[model samples]
Target: MSEKNREGKRTARERMAAEREKHKAAEKRRRALIVGASVVCVLALAAVIGVIAANAGKDDSSDSEGPAVAPSGAQGEDSLVIPVGKAGAASTLVVWEDFRCPACKSFEDTYRSTIHELTDAGRLRVEYRLATIIDGNLGGTGSRSAANAAACAQDAGKFVDYHDVLYQNQPAETDDAFSENAKLFELAAKVEGLDTPAFRSCVEDGTHNSWVAKSNDAFRSGGFTGTPTVLLDGKNIYQDQSMTPEKLKQQVQEAAKG
Candidate 1:
């Protein structure tokens, strides 16, 4: 072959090699993309499974036996001052709550809407057990004041209303604005049929001291290390941010079936 022809053949071979390299690089990029996508999908699936497992653990932990109860008083009493559900229902759930607990507030909201339906149907009853874990956190005044005010409102036959208002007006967990005794009184006055003077006097004179102490003692005996511990038919129902009205309703329905 002539020299030029030979050179042309060599050039053609080089071009073919360059094209192969390009294809190889493209294949490598495609493989990387596929691997990255697979990793993301696996990660997403793992996250979903983790959330489900965490929720299941929470449900199991909450279903453990609740705190111990004393022989008498608020914890052991058959009746509660703050009526939670309807007047007469076979299955009653008693909630021991701290006014300053955000989780308690969430539980209260869920119960208020859903329990109202159950109560209206006469399928469920609810009772509030005022727990005061916030006392020490709130400079030893907020929790006691809120509990006392609730008791005082009970004396005035407006415990439920007062309880609702307290939860609505609850301050941030990091802040202790609910510590003001005066604010407690203010909330009491807002309850219809509540005589402001009588309620204030009761709060000031510690007329509800026994009730407050009893509630706190019950909370302690119940092995509640935190606020918003719930008791469903004497069984503890653990609550957290993930607790929803649907889950509670399902639990209640299951218990009713038994």
Candidate 2:
């Protein structure tokens, strides 16, 4: 064949291959769209079913006494209670946190810095409830253990500091995670003013077991359906994967201004 003709044929073959690739890509995208649509339809149907089930008056409340203290608007000086920012600060922010939740970890990393700044400036009071709802299901014993240790730290008057540390050093949601009991104790000791011996003993003996259970019970009662659920001034903050620090700051700002 003539060289020119050979080159033209080669180019035509390449174009055909490219066209085939494009066609395959389009088909793949169409299939993906179909799958995504089906998923959305299934989720919507499930949601409706869930609403019916929830309204069916099913008692999912765990058998335990309620939270140690109800979330009242009461304020106290020197009470270990979570502070409500400044006087007349629009809202009380309460976070129901599960240590083993990766999303909670992200929320902590995102909000900790800003919240600290606000707290330092006397602009917001943030309260936390360390619940273990995802314990056995997600992190198993490790989750429960970390929560237990946190409760001990709280008793030692280092709840806020130790709580931050727990979230900071949280392990993955797996069996291997609980192996860090020593690390948890180590972190707890770093909280100044905490009685290390007492904290360690409490963790070892599971002294805060009942309290943790009670907190979990209260978490359910407060309408918390998921971990890292945030309550701003007693209103729920609906969160999604795209929730950002700037958005949270704006929420806080709006709440503070009100």
Candidate 3:
């Protein structure tokens, strides 16, 4: 072969090699950019998730934060009962309730008027015993916290009003909004003169948390079915499907006559 032809062919081969190297370098840079972008996206997603988790936890009330103390005028075993109405009433209605329980709210909505009328007439006395069954079952602190807040209201002689207000504004069982102290105080504002500094302090400190816990323990030990366990003179009247508010009133009146 001619020398010029050989030189030309060698130059052409070198140029092709250089072009291939350039393409390889470009591909490596492209891969590096893709990897870097993916890492950045992952980190950003993690940060967003962290923020959401933190916000959720901020409002999640924890029932294990402090010792339980019974509220003023708390009666019955271990001072767990918050009594509404005169002590000497003819019929005693015992209620086991969870503020976060929807059934309890349903009961309240249905019989609140009848119960209040009877209580105000000094015919029936309601012994409200709080439970945290919802909290135990659903994995949250709203029940306990709300119970503690009710106990605080009991201390201020505003339990019945505050209790009704709570039921009126009870959140969904899964929402856990009552775990926030602010929400509790917000509901307290509904009860006339209930949002006192002492009340707020009591709720904030979970002053009755231990008492609430003990009440919940007692409820579990009692072998009750669920919240709104309304007993009229040792009978689970709430379980009586034929019974109504009128029937309850009649029964109470009959007992008063006896």
Candidate 4:
């Protein structure tokens, strides 16, 4: 063969090799794009699933079948407010509270007797609005559970007694102790005839849980951030620094007169 012909054959071979290298590089890039697309799709799907689960959880806490209907004898829009005074009393004292709130316990301990005295005399009616702000803020079910139990007590015609007992034995804010059914029944036993099987069943079943949720929703919509919010004839007296038990009683009497 001629030397030039041999060199031409070598050059052809080199050209073919370079083409094969280019094809391999293009194939690798295609595979890399495919892998990256798969990864992105998987991440998007996971994020969608995560969002769905989170929304479902929120619905479980907030939504319910047939909406939350307030129980019988309940006052206020959501029926969370249990009236504690005479049917035709002159003034309405509304109290928004959470069973697990320490400040609420203090308010109860200080003014429970005064409230009852006023109510018994038909001087004013006290409306109790239950709330579960602690559960949302602190990550637990104690407030909801206690509120359910209280509503159950309302059904059994022992709301005031149960309310007093709950505040009297309120657990620390961080303890979440009221999340237990047994503890609630035990406290119910303190109230005369409140620890019956029916009461226990109601508490265990959480029959009023939805109602409690409704109450919390009402509290949120009422635009109050904390518990023990006391209102006199729609006025927020609890916000007043000088408001004491005596002052509250005086205000009620004065309202009664006018």
Using TM-score as the measure, the top candidate is: 4
Per-residue lDDT of candidate 2, residues 1-258 (tens digit): 999999999999999999999999999999999999999999999999999986563222222333333222323322223443566565567777778888899888878887787766666777766666666354345655676677676666676788788778776665436436677767766778765777778778766555556667666666767888887666666465555667767877786676
Tens digit per residue, CA lDDT, model 4, 1-258 = 999999999999999999999999999999999999999999999999999987763533342445564655897664667888797888988899988899999988888888888999999898898888888878788888898888888888999999999999999999898999988988998999989888888888778788888888778887895888998899988788898889988988887798
TM-score rank, highest first? 4, 3, 2, 1
Question: Which residue pairs come into collision in candidate 1?
Answer: 62-238, 67-222, 68-222
Scored against the true structure, residue 159 in model 2 reaches a CA lDDT of 68
The lDDT ranking, best first, is: 3, 4, 1, 2
> Could you give candidate 3's per-residue lDDT for residues 84-105 as a string of tens digits?
8989998999999999999999
Tens-place lDDT digits, model 1, residues 99-170: 888988887776777777776676787777776676644445566667767777777667778888999888
User: What is residue 221's positional error in candidate 3, in angstroms?
Assistant: 0.6
* lDDT score for residue 203 of model 2: 75
- Model 3 misplacement above 4 A: 1-67
TM-score of each: 0.61, 0.61, 0.75, 0.85
Q: Lowest-scoring 10 consecutive residues by lDDT in candidate 2?
A: 71-80
> Candidate 4: which pairs clash?
none
Model 1 weakest lDDT span, ten residues long: 57-66
Candidate 2 — which residues are off by over 4 angstroms?
1-88, 193-195, 238-243, 254-258
